[model samples]
Target: MHWITTTHIAVTWMLVGLIWVVQILVYPQFSRVAARDFPEYHFAHCFRIALIVVPQMFVEAATAVWLLHEGIRATPFLISAGLILVVWLSTAVFQAPTHIRLMRKFDASLIHHVTLTNWIRTLAWTARGFLVSFALS
Candidate 1:
């Protein structure tokens, strides 16, 4: 049971790290390319990310609650999970609409805005990875 909890924590952190890398390094490059030649596809890609993000936000929140209930007493992990929830909520509330508008308008400027907004998520997820790792240790 302890091993399972530890594994879950580790896996969560790994996922967070993977997501951060994708957002910070991979997605930005893709965004730049999309802005230049494939604006429509870029807009579509943003929408696709939103589709994944929305559900992921809920899942993370639920997982956090479950971890707490299961007696994970790492303050850093709990706090980080809480922060991630807040960030995800902000993304859903603030960024999602902006992305929707950008998707409709298909403007280069909007793509830049989207890319800038994604920085928050990238950093937040990276922080989450660190926090989770600390908790597991």
Candidate 2:
């Protein structure tokens, strides 16, 4: 297997697992945070997650692009790329706004919305991880 494809699969799997952790463990804990301290906590959450997120996203994206350019196993590569797009779009369009509201105030409604909507990303990443694993196999 090409290293690009292998790296892409690895990074894709990382995001898949990380998103699940965020969905199951992190986001659900938002409501438990004291309102007065929520903003600071939310900021740290956003800041720290971004640290892991932004670079890994780039690595995944770069590897996807490289794999596409390599012109092997195009179908799986494209599907996985499309799923990555969905994850990015959903994160920016759906989740980021919800996080913003939480940063401003710990609204349970926003927390609910974020956690629920994040399933889209979590499932998409799951599918991506499966696809890339198939590619590796």
Question: Which candidate comes out best when scored by lDDT?
Answer: 2
The worst-scoring run of ten residues by lDDT in candidate 1 lies at 30-39
Question: What is the C-alpha lDDT profile of model 2 across 61-110, one tens digit per residue?
Answer: 88887777777565765787899899999989999988887889878899
How well does each candidate superpose onto the true structure, as a TM-score? 0.70, 0.95
- Per-prediction count of colliding residue pairs? 0, 0
Query: Per-residue lDDT tens digits of candidate 1, residues 31-133?
Result: 4563345557656676676576556555666677777888877789777867776677667776677767765555657656766776777677767767876
For candidate 2, give the lDDT of residue 96: 91
Number of the predicted model whose TM-score against the real structure is largest? 2
**Local accuracy by lDDT, each model:** 0.66, 0.88
Instruction: Candidate 1: give the clashing pairs.
Output: none
Model 2 is weakest, by summed lDDT over 10 consecutive residues, at 69-78
Candidate 2 pairs with clashing backbones: none
